[model samples]
Target: MTSIPPTDFRSFLSSVGRVFAVFFRQGRKARRTRFFFLFSFLPVAVSLVIKFNQVFSGKPGREGGYLFTNLIMLFYLQMIILILALFYGTSVCSEELEGKTLAYLITRPIPKAAIVLGKYAAYMAVMTGMVILGLIFSFFVLNVDRLLDPSLYGLLGRYLGVLILGLMAYGAFFTFLGSSLKRSIFFGLLFSFGWENVIQYFPGSTQRLAIAHYLKSFLPATSSGRFSFLTFRLEPTKPGLALLMLFAIAAAFLALACLFFSKKEYSLED
Candidate 1:
């Protein structure tokens, strides 16, 4: 049996810290890093349209309110988080490769896992920050009158938690694709809109295979449209099971990413 090296918490923490610094500096220097702006502001643009439509069409009272609020959650997941995660997540390793810095990082004493994880941590920071900001913006735009209501805060908290979980799950999967495949973004797009969106709508147990399926299961059933884009009823999974599945998906993909990044021979030409 291979003997594992003794664990050192201090060393691990130091490596993580170093990786964070490098990725953040790289992010700052990357001129094309408009993802932050695009992700942060796109929700505002959408909310403006929705707000106006709601004003003209009249308020969706009570149950309509539930559908509208939950639709925002679904829209945020499908549109904002899905696109942002695909673009940025798939760029985690590819960006380094493009800059020709990945080779240098590999040669250093830092563990490859640490580097992969560090980059993921940095990605999480930026993605989560933008998502939270977008959520707040959308909330205010759509619910300006309800903003001061104390009950809305609790609902916001729940939605934010689910959004973050969805981000982490999708982020890890796309990050893995970036590390493992040459043309990750193209495939990621196909999988996001093509596979995930389509599969989740399929009736019966097959829908459970998609990450979005589990996410939808976490939505409160107070609204008829909480988990469905159409009139088709959604199969509900236990909240605990859904949450567990999300964490599992995130952990599984992240592990694959680390393993692939540590072993692969990446070309710097891209």
Candidate 2:
């Protein structure tokens, strides 16, 4: 197989580093954009409210624990990842265009692939931090007693792993959308809430095309009657295959983003 020259590889690495550094310094833009920080904090806030009400009402603790975990892990946590990934991923390159900085960024001594990939890396890093903080807040606000249980911590770790996998997949897909489409957010929303939500319920191989299909396969099976509406009939995929699917999806989308970015022209006029 042909291999890249060492000098070329080193230059690509350096370009990646430079792009990462610039975006890393500008990471605060994520929080400032349309009150994203508040949206990120929302899961914890709702959990806290529920926890306090349970304590004040002297409700039974067992049921409350279940509610906290479900809300944090299934509802709030997933919502945060989906929403933030869509917003951040779809805006990564578009923001530069909006700020009239695309010309400056593109003119730099960097490979086009490095520019797209670097912004992708920076976006993932920022999302990772936000998701971790949200998880921690939900954990503590639910109750400090959970920290005493080693099994609970182990479970949380697994759940976090699944969430991160989902983030990487969804983030890359939306980033590809942003790079390729002018009205990406609108379509992204449709895919997340409309297509991903409904298509899994379809019969046969048709459902497999959606990202959420693989994600659901990675989650521990639940007899959550409260969320029966969200359940779809499908054989669970092995964890290894599910993880691989997410990685493959992310790689494919990011590669497409790089290809599109390299070919498309950006301008202040648009």
Candidate 3:
């Protein structure tokens, strides 16, 4: 009878540790990662400066209106998540292939799925952290008087939840694209700024295809009034339906990402 060597739990944990260490080390060397953080914060900073000026000018109502509008637009949140997810998702596997380092990792006694999942988890963590930091800054700027209306707080909470779901869905979608395309970044940008933005204006069921539609539905109706021209100009979904749609989109995209990554042959010199 052939005897199998005992699988050591400690060894498994050590391997996981090494995976994270490698991820962080590579992150430090990736200038794009640093630039992502910088660009993510810039819009939030600009919005805050404008809000402060409004507040000091005895225009608190205007300041509140701007805060409500900016939060609904969530330009900083959406753009940062989309950019990070596109670059990080595609680059995680693509970079390894480019540097010829993927072979070494795959040669180890680790599942390819683990490599993909670990990298995905790390990217999400970094992107989420950047977004939450921006949210905190926005909150401080908007709420300097520390006065909170229950309705406003509730709207903020709903928007935050929707933002999180948007990240998950967009991240998974771009991650799948990264696995499938050599020039995923360019295409990802086009889909984000072009297709999604364009399609949301289409009538009825067509608009439902875009995640942004459901996300906007989750914001307060008063907030929606601010961007009525850009939105579908339809009634916002009920909270329950909006949440369901967001989660459904995330799940569908993640499944597609996993399917592609599991079957595709990743090549270095594409």
Best by TM-score: 2
Between prediction 1 and prediction 3, the one with superior TM-score is: 1
Model 1, residue 66: displacement in angstroms? 4.1
Model 1 clash pairs? none
Better of 1 and 2 by TM-score: 2
List model 2 lDDT by residue over 13-117, tens digit each: 999988888886677574563376667778788888877887888875545346555666666434778888898888777777777878887888898889888
Q: What is the C-alpha lDDT of each candidate?
A: 0.78, 0.77, 0.68
In the range 1-270, model 3's lDDT, one tens digit per residue, is: 965355755555556566667786676567877888787776577667777687677765545545645542556444666777778877766777677887788888865655665666677767777776776666656666655656656655665676676777777777777767778889999988888777777787778777777777775555344444545454566778977877777566656666676678876675
| Model 1 regions lying over 4 Å from their true place | 1-9, 28-32, 49-71, 222-231
Task: Specify the poorest-scoring 10-residue window by lDDT in model 3.
Answer: 223-232
Return the candidate ranking by lDDT, descending.
1, 2, 3
Best by lDDT: 1
The CA-based lDDT of model 2 is what? 0.77
Model 2 stretches with alpha carbons more than 4 Å out? 29-34, 61-65, 76-78, 228-230
